[model samples]
Target: MRLMIVAALTLVCVAPAVAQDFTAAPNYGDVRLAPGFSPDPHLVVVQAGGSIDVDGTLSNCSGFITSAPDLRLFWDGNGSLDLKVSAISNADTTLVISGPNGAWYCDDDGGDGSNPSVTLSSVSGQYDIWVGTFDDGETRSAVLSISELSSF
Candidate 1:
């Protein structure tokens, strides 16, 4: 009888802990720009299972415009993703991508931001996108856009 009572007490103590399962949503956003010819870009944030449409120009990328624009996204680190952009004369523009785990990728002197899709290769979390000129005192511009996919 004492063993039965102890078993009941143990189950009652452990039930609440097991019932408290939790999952976290990731964060997203863009970084600020330093003083340069390129105007300060902007960003919009969406929910964990949300989508965002981006349209803007990386204009006048001359005179100390050595850094790329920042486009960031946040999620639960598990989903499908798509990043789309179109460009005009991308000869002077560059593409920079920042991913989870401190991964960085870039495209040098491309035709505007005219590109296909940038999909997440591994588990998804928060990723940053950016663009800029080569800082050679030559003006450049490009249009950017995005399309996101996920299952929450």
Candidate 2:
């Protein structure tokens, strides 16, 4: 039970940022890290069987932005995941993704506050990503959009 508790605690980005409804993209579901999973920060294998989408709104996420305890994402397929912020609101956001053949991305209000996009290209593995407020603990609507480009 303790191991299950730990694993559950590890994968979720909780105490979110807003109060609106969230419609996650297709292939979306709760993802968990299984036992005996690789300690490799390079690959996050899925456990049980569910997939989190590339795009969705995170609501009421309460916390300050910090470099540690970021979320992990695994592409596991060839193509790029264009991770962007706020296709739905005017929340100022910062997105950082690292991994996959030296594809390290970080963006802060690159679009307009209107938006910003950080794309990870040539992906075929896991990645670690985080969404942060331009200011800490700013409870507002933050939308994350993930698009699969050149999917083959």
Candidate 3:
């Protein structure tokens, strides 16, 4: 009976941490691109920050992001070029990406100033991305940039 009680308690504790769903439709929009596509950097304006806290969810993952992804990227090309995803905001921003390989990558302050950037090497397929804020439930205007050469 004690073990059963413990199991139920554990399930309740773990439920909230699993709230972020990468499969859900994005808040911004989706983009399809191939290697060597024109416009080296594709930009999208977005609102960064949400209620979901990702600090203890995974190693190197921090900040607060929405349950739904902010953007979805469909890359139609061979895995030959590197892809860089970044966010530029006045407030401290973070980034989280679910790669095509089912791997999670996060970055805080990897770009200029308080922005965040994550670079994936030899990438293809779908990338679900979120631009988050360092603080919880604080939304800020941010520009998400997808680039092959440089980060903004």
Could you tell which candidate, 1 or 3, scores higher by TM-score?
Answer: 3
TM-score of each: 0.39, 0.44, 0.89
Per-residue lDDT over 69-119 for candidate 3, one digit per residue giving the tens place of the 0 to 100 score: 999999976666788899999999999999899899999988998899988
Off by over 4 Å in 1: 1-69, 75-77, 81-91, 109-119, 134-139, 148-152
Ranking by lDDT: 3, 2, 1
Residue 21 error for model 3, in Å?
0.6
Give candidate 2's whole-model lDDT: 0.40
Candidate 2 Cα deviation (angstroms), residue 127: 1.3
Q: What is the lDDT of residue 132 in candidate 2?
A: 52
| TM-score of candidate 3 versus the correct structure, residues matched by position | 0.89
lDDT of 2 at 89: 40
Q: Write the per-residue lDDT of candidate 2 for residues 71-100, one digit (tens) a residue.
A: 445555454334232222455555545565
Q: After superposition, which runs of candidate 3 have C-alpha atoms over 4 Å from their true positions? A: 1-16
> Which structure is stronger by lDDT: 1 or 2?
2
